[model samples]
Target: MSLPENFNGWEHLQKTYMLEYNRRVDKFFSDVQGNGDLSNVRSSLKLACRLVDGDNEATWSLRTSLFFDVIGYSRKNLSIFYGSNIDTALPVAGHPQLFLYFSQDSQAVPLNGKRLDHEKSCRLTRYACKSGQSLPAVTKANLLDIAHEIKAQFVSGGKGIIYTAGKLSVSYTDPANGFPKGTRWLVNSKSEAIELYGKLCNVIDRPFDINKMNVNTPEKDSTTQVINTTDTILGKQYKQYAYRPVANLRFRYAYVSFGGSASPIFLIDTTFRNTALIA
Candidate 1:
């Protein structure tokens, strides 16, 4: 869809863009599940290119988020590994190829101790399938190709394509209140996530520092606490410590790779404090 000429503010534009983005994401998965065809996926990618063709904050954000979505999809579904040195010499028959890799100087070192020259080798976004079947370097121009390769190598060929509903279940503590008693919100897009973060910031009268928040992955569980202090100095000094409203966002993924059980309660979760956080 074409961006509207007349719009509200950046947030409004972002919300509008996210609406379309979510629609596309849903449609992509729907098509994949419906018939395993990628024609509509290619069309959607082309439309994304058109939407993000310009050099602007909105377009840049869309492009970056779209790429991250692709990466997230791969991480959630495929059994891929990432690092500077990955053993690619040993070939496993019938096993899904590690389609993602990082190599220096467009060269990859195989387990046989041979340095193979590859023009497409990139630091983190390189895509390589079998010999003579390599895609171009991951870039905005090659997103469609990269996506197609990811599907062909990982999703198809009986490689065990895992599927999720694509909903980020979020439950955050009411910053006005304390933990163990908060609210939950289901987020389906990045814009909604940003809006939710804004709401939490408004409640606390401060910007939320995600770095300070705790995370509870599928493998492990954790907790956090918020404390306040007050001091009085007269003839002597006195101090009082109490609890304050502090929120921590947590993420939990339901993929088996993340240590999830066969049957998961939720595909993903974003909880606050003791509550489940968004992913």
Candidate 2:
């Protein structure tokens, strides 16, 4: 086939270029809908950007483009489905388009100030995600740090106990913040939320505020006003954990199965999300 005038000369080469971009863009969307960590997606794209620019000197001469949103994964991943016609770096319509837009799927408006999704911030540190400095040698922040890292996101009210028996985090009454109608817990995933709800089932003797909010329906005129913390506005009580912000998190670990038995030491999970030895 003959090349057209606007073909950019290297037709065969251009096809190759677009091919890889197409594959990456497709994979990118798959990960997002899957609700994969935004960081992981970016890491992959940054890797692709490196791989596509391989040893080819001429390819480097090309723009070698991609888009990333500090909020979610790079937009380049989504744009592929629409044929790379994206403006490259501009924000999209309702949300930031070319760039990453921050908004809740439930709400139509874009997140104005600080929108949030669980970034890979789920790293495991020696101490814990909530409590820092369990040990000196283990300094790197891990995934567990995610919960604590985002603690400040919620407004402080009073004192309460956070149930930690299973996967779901125990949310509390944020009467200070419109109870469940206003704000919720800082959970890492829906699984974590489930764990909290499961626990609530057995202990719903009292009208626990946070859990009630999650399970029950908010009043019809429930327009969220301020994101501040309050003291017993709805039903349940209120409490707060002092907030702290952490940039990076660690999720890996080391383990030994046999404590008494003589066995070789072993390196535990790779990414830090999975557990190596459960005793």
Which residue pairs overlap in candidate 1's backbone?
269-277, 270-276, 270-277, 270-278, 271-276, 271-277
Instruction: Name the lDDT value of residue 59 in candidate 2.
Output: 45
User: What are the lDDT figures for the candidates, one per model?
Assistant: 0.32, 0.30
Q: What are the clash counts of all predictions, listed in order?
A: 6, 28
Model 2, 1-279: lDDT tens digits are 876767665756766866775555444343233323335533454444432434465544332443223323343123122213342421111110011011122232233312222211011112221223343322123322322322222112211122211122324443222122222433434554555433332221123333454432223322222234546758876543213111112222222121122231222322222232221
**Model 2, residue 271: what's the lDDT?**
22
Compare the candidates by lDDT and give the number of the best one. 1
Model 1 worst lDDT window (10 residues): 116-125
For each candidate in turn, the TM-score is: 0.17, 0.25
Q: Which ten residues in a row have the lowest lDDT in candidate 2?
A: 92-101
Could you give candidate 1's per-residue lDDT for residues 61-99 as a string of tens digits?
A: 765466446524323333333323443332212111112
Q: What TM-score, to 2 decimals, does candidate 2 have?
A: 0.25
Q: What is the lDDT of residue 91 in candidate 1?
A: 22
Candidate 1 local accuracy as lDDT?
A: 0.32
